[model samples]
Target: MSTTEKSNEKRCERDGREKVDKFRRFLAQFCATTVENLLLFDMGLCHSFPFIIIAALTGFPNKHNLNETLSLTPIEASWLASIGYISEPIGSLLSALITDALGRKVAMMVVNIPLVVAWFLMYSASSVWQIFLAIVLLGLGAGLMESPIITYVGEISEPTFRGVMIAYTHFGYSLGAILVATLNIMMPWRMVGLVCMFTPIFTTIALCFVPETPLWLLSKNKTAQAEKALCWLRGWVPKESVAEELQSLQRYSERYKSCESCIKKDQKCIHPLPTLAEKLKELKRKQTLKPFSIVMALFCISVFSTTFSMSTYIVQILKAYNIPMEPDEAAAVLSYVNNLGNISFLCLIRFTGKRYLYLTILSILFLSAAVICGYGFMVLPIGYSSFPDLSPNFPLENSNLGYIPFVCIILSSFCIFCGINSMAWQMISEVFPYKTRGTATGLTAALSYVLSFIGAKTFYSLETTLSMPGVALFNCIIIAFGLILMYKILPETENRTLEDIEMHFSDNSKKLTDRKIPKLDLSQIGSAKNNSNMPTRPVSIKGIDEQNNKKSGIGCDNRSFVADS
Candidate 1:
């Protein structure tokens, strides 16, 4: 034991500890940011790419003419515009299987393939059908990616991070819209479409380095892998705490699967793999149904908010209402404002609870849309002027009402972006128990997109028939219904653990299992056995030996314990 040798050993030990600490921090940081980035890349691009295409087409219809260039009539062009939404439900349905079977990372990868193809098709699109085909593929990618991406982010991030991670869906969407607005100004629509292809490509490459979600790994029975993944995710924590955290997730996984089973039943009887019908049945059992209903209501509100259609036809809608700015310029400004709103909401999400944020946003949107409708009603009698050549058959009576519609859209975009658009995605991830999350989320997405398809397809006709104000009024009513449903049904999930949320739904079952069972008077039984030293006598400890009193044999009935002497 030389002094020099001891000094060298101490230095080595300190260096080893430092290295371990650094690696742990690196793992934690990597897991948090990397998973979220992947989610944003997959979901945001898919969700917004179609919006970008529509933005460009709406902002510069004459330049990118389907009528002149591709021979698409008005009806055909409208159909083509909405066909992407038509295919979304199918993609959404398929995503449940993909996510459950292939894992979240792989599901995202598969969805990106279609999106890349869709972009390339848009780049080389020679006819309306080719464009339609491109959008259909885009819809597929968007549909499949939506549920899985939300689920993946929800499962990977801490509860504190889940809101922001889910909010990435909106952030990604706004970014794409901004890109479309800016790029359309800089280049041709085709080139912009080509440029969009790069996002999915780059994201796909980046995803290869990211780990799969620990929750999904646990669902697939990969306990070892799940522990490793969870450890890395919580790597900044002490090693012992990480192990405990992993154990908590495993327990949650088990309880989530068997929450519907009887409290006293043996664990083996609790069915871990429920059929779709059984899952649906479980959902109908009030406890699970409440959250499921709340999620659906939120999705419906978000989908029908008609912000998507407004974004798509921002130029036309603005021009129709006599917005003073050029349609292209107005579209770009609105897109930028909408992007800013999304960013603002993402930032605000970290500070607020989900319940308050959702209600507040929806209320603002409802009021804003109502004001727009009232203005439309008020202005109709006064005679208004709009861009003349834009819609000749629908002639404009001249007036300077342009600023009014422009301000309305700014307000509308701000409200929609700040509210339902981001909240719905975050809520979907927060509400569902992990056991049925993939299927439940997929169903919600499929239904929402179906509503979206209807809204997009009917939007032009609705505006033509009912006018912009009427459309706003229609949306206001839907928002009102959503607000009611949400207030009654939506639970506050902000900063709450997924286990806590699941437990909220399982309280009734927990009550049954947690009911106090009467304890036996073991002390009394012990005293009787010790004092009497009786082999044949049955000692009553609560009701354990009540049945033995009926036995006539020397030995007490086995239904109750017999004292041995």
Candidate 2:
């Protein structure tokens, strides 16, 4: 071999090694966000597909020729649309237990089972009852999926990127809305349902490849598993690379575990498990309750802001009340604009401290727009009566104000998509501590859906009695009340870590000093000659600490523990 050939071969080998190392670095960086993003996106799709299917179905109510195929009455159709909202609370409760017990991955996969059944049921259904049942099933699936998705994503992502992850999920929902609206414009509703089924199935399949969250594994006392999970979530970094993160999570879980165990021992000197009341009391501590309270209020505001109401039934409401724009066209436009607006606003969430401003101002704007649009409906209908010579659809000829409702609808949609909808969901994901995250989020979600169900069920009836404009005016009042209440309370969570946020609640500024209870040696007391006539008080951890502290006259010194009876 020649010297020239040998030198050339060595250079080529060095170049190949450099390229491989570069690719490895890229893959490691990409995998961290990529796996989590995909999981969240899939769950987002699962949450939204049912809503998309129903929204598309409501876009047009013509018999079997388009979006609405079922021959059903107004009230019956309203029941069909509202059933999902009604069923979600039940699912939320179930998800809390499932996610806390079985792990987030299992809960995610379990939710898909019912979603598949619901979509499949709707695909072949012929009766109103059958369709209603399917919607109920889908609602259950949504309820079950909500807590785990938000909780799991929040636990898994870094603080710097958490808002973006949440925003992406919101974007996924808007994308689903846009896709279904666009597809229903060209395809049948049944086909949309069939297509929607693919999301949950694919989500389940994709989740199989991802590990459980490190926090969840840690909570289960599986330290080894938690380390491996952390490594995977960090993009296959060396186990040593994630050691700091793993230690932090373990410390958190251990602290929580310590706070949860009973300190009192029986005569046998063995510590028993904490009672149910003790657990509930622990959760009610200032750190947990404060955030939980704030989150619940925001959750209520998010729902009543007409986020779910307008998203699901804007098409039906407009078409039923004789609005000029095509319902499906309006939905598609609204979803497209919503996605764009959501993306734009989400970009600002991390950079700005204007979350409260954005929420309050935009929410009021949204509800007011709804009011004006509703009034347009009322005015347009009355315009027909005013002009005896013209038809109802000819309101544009009489006045240039005909475009007011469509403009208001667009304004309302822009406000909601741009601010409150995404903010509220992201806040819920950020607010709760890990110990009670599932329970608090689940309960708040259930309550949110309760408000949603009320709005959905009463929308048609409210329109019937008060006209569309009147209903909007009514919702405006309710939403304004909520926004005002929220403004006084909601905390800014942008670019903040989970621990940092909890510190605000757990910090020493509150001066909630623990009252020192001197542990009494009961055996020593039993043998004391001076306490022969004293009453023996049972030492239970319930309200015992308070009662004993108030009346037991217990006193202590450094050298020896003493109790005054």
| CA deviation > 4 Å runs, candidate 2 | 1-59, 62-69, 260-278, 281-283, 320-324, 354-357, 360-378, 381-394, 398-400, 507-565
**Can you give the lDDT of residue 52 in candidate 1?**
41
Per-residue lDDT tens digits for candidate 1, residues 379-464, read 65322222122344242355566576568678778877886777777777766666567888888888888878877787667766
Cα lDDT tens digits for candidate 2, 412-466: 7766766766666777887676657788788778877887788767756665666
Worst 10 residues of 1 by lDDT: 556-565
Query: For model 2, what is the alpha-carbon lDDT of residue 72?
Result: 56
lDDT of 2 at 10: 99
Model 1 TM-score, 2 decimals: 0.78
Query: How many clashing residue pairs, candidate 1?
Result: 2
Candidate 1 residue 225 Cα shift, in angstroms, is: 1.8
Whole-model lDDT for model 2 versus the true structure? 0.61
Q: Count the backbone clashes (under 3 Å) in each candidate.
A: 2, 2
**Which candidate has the top score in TM-score?**
1
Clashing residue pairs in candidate 2 are 374-469, 375-469
